[model samples]
Target: MAARPLDVAFKALAHPDRRRLLDLTREETSVGELVNATGLTQPAVSQHLRTLREARLITARSDGTRRLYRVDTELLDEVRRYLDGFWTDRLGRLKAVAETIDDGTTP
Candidate 1:
């Protein structure tokens, strides 16, 4: 069976290294630059980039010998929308409970 998009995204984001890589890619970066910035080995940085690519969280383009990577904001927005639904509902319920308490109402 294939994994869901959200599951894949969450898995990709589970690692701190991967998250850091994503943050660095916000401005279109190469593997060498990532290694220099994060103090990680080239192979390790590449591995994180590969996972982010698979998750569609980042995009890559070849600029001659160097491959540039950038964050995929649309995908991140989709993930955020999915997570926001839960928070919105939870906050709404919490507000209702608080209002009830203020009114001295018991359920």
Candidate 2:
């Protein structure tokens, strides 16, 4: 993902409450259900949902009088790929350090 998009995804996930909301909405949920489950006000849930949608982490569908939200798999894939880069680099550094230690570089 682009730098701006990465920033948006990170910011959206920076909140514990938003993360919980995403967990609860993993299988499609409505705003009312999320508010009830999280004990947050409707407006608060709506605001979080808006952020998630804006970050492309969640998708919404209108169902009669209510709108249901679901996680966006493709968006998550992009986020995962971005994070995986860090993992790959960290693991490589760790391996190098381990090899050096084994070579008597330091105790």
Candidate 3:
């Protein structure tokens, strides 16, 4: 079965290098800038950018001779919201357990 878009995004984010690329692209940046920031070869940076682009985690545009890249914040926000739901549920359970402990009861 094909992976969902969110699954693809999570997979793409699994790499530290790709995460760094996303961080660097928080501000609109070029491939050259990404290479400089990452201390990676131009081709390596391009490959990372392609992965991010495929995940819909970033957007690119032509700027004369350069290609500018930026994070697609909406998609990122969707990912964030999905993750937050899990945190919320876990925290809620923790809170319940804490309350039980405070009341001298085992959870």
Candidate 4:
């Protein structure tokens, strides 16, 4: 079975190629353009784009004979929330450690 949508989104972003593809989608692009930017085969770029679409990280539309992709703002917001929470959680733990150290607890 496949994972949840959030898991799938994160998995898609786990690949550097896919992350770059997502970033490039910020301005809408065709597979050929991404191929040029990443120095990958057109088919490879299309495959990565397919994975991103499946993960709902990007959306595509027909621009004449070419397909153009755009970033899915909602998904990006969710990703931002997840990353922000991770940093906030880490900071909380670090703060606790600092407080304990200030109390003269040595380790």
Q: Go through the candidates in order and give the C-alpha RMSD of each one to the true structure.
A: 4.2, 5.0, 4.7, 5.2
Please provide TM-scores, in order, for all candidate models, with all chains considered together. 0.74, 0.72, 0.73, 0.70
Global local distance difference test of model 1: 0.91
Question: Which is the better candidate, 1 or 2, if ranked by TM-score?
Answer: 1
The whole-model lDDT of each prediction reads: 0.91, 0.89, 0.91, 0.88
- Residue 42 of model 1: what lDDT? 95
Q: Model 4, which residues run further than 4 Å from truth?
A: 79-107
Please give the TM-score that candidate 1 achieves against the real structure.
0.74
Tens digit per residue, CA lDDT, model 2, 1-107: 55687688889999998899889988989998998899999999999999989988889999999999998777778877979999999999999999988899555
Worst 10 residues of 4 by lDDT: 71-80
User: Which candidate has the top score in TM-score?
Assistant: 1
Error of 4 at 65 (Å): 0.5
After best superposition, candidate 3 residue 50: deviation in angstroms? Answer: 0.3
Misplaced by over 4 Å in model 1 are 83-107
Tens digit per residue, CA lDDT, model 3, 1-55: 9989888998999999999999998899999888888899999999989999999
Query: Which model scores highest in lDDT?
Result: 3
Tens digit per residue, CA lDDT, model 4, 49-103: 8898899989999989999998887877887899999999999999999998888
Between the candidate structures 2 and 4, which one is better when assessed by lDDT? 2
Best-to-worst order by lDDT is 3, 1, 2, 4
Arrange candidates by TM-score, highest first: which order? 1, 3, 2, 4
User: After best superposition, candidate 3 residue 80: deviation in angstroms?
Assistant: 4.3
